[model samples]
Target: MESEIDRFPVKSLMERYSITRSVLYKRLKGLGIVPTKFGRQSYVTGKELTLLDQLHDPNCNPRDVNRWRVD
Candidate 1:
């Protein structure tokens, strides 16, 4: 992603990830993520996409996350 590319549409992202609207919002919200607020057009940043990837990644481990630290 580049500085010029600020965000991605939530619907397209949902389609790519096979996520439902409620699931997408719930997951993103739980991870402290939010989209840019506009009139009838919400969108998430590239940073959010990266974060989402990390959270949903098959290779991610419980110990890899600082917030969910494990002994």
Candidate 2:
């Protein structure tokens, strides 16, 4: 099981990425990233967060899924 420290809530992710909830979910869906559910809340793993950061990085190529190390 993943520890709490390794998980980030959806709301926090929105703030961290400076995006709205709709945009965040849309990006995640486009990236094929499904957030884990904890009761009524949703979260993304630390690894996913790293990928998200890269996805939003101006210097990175969003189309390069193989380089993301998502698996």
**Candidate that would win on lDDT:** 2
At residue 28, candidate 2 shows an lDDT of 84
* Cα-lDDT of candidate 1: 0.69
Give candidate 1 regions above 4 Å deviation. 1-4, 61-71
lDDT of each: 0.69, 0.79
RMSD of 1: 4.9
Q: Write the per-residue lDDT of candidate 2 for residues 1-71, one digit (tens) a residue.
A: 86546888887887887889898987787667788999999988887887798888988776775555444
**Per-candidate TM-score against the hidden true structure:** 0.68, 0.73
Tell me the tens digit of each residue's lDDT in model 1 across 1-71: 64655788777767877878887876666666767766788887777777777867878763444463112
Q: State how far residue 20 of model 1 sits from its true place (Å).
A: 1.4
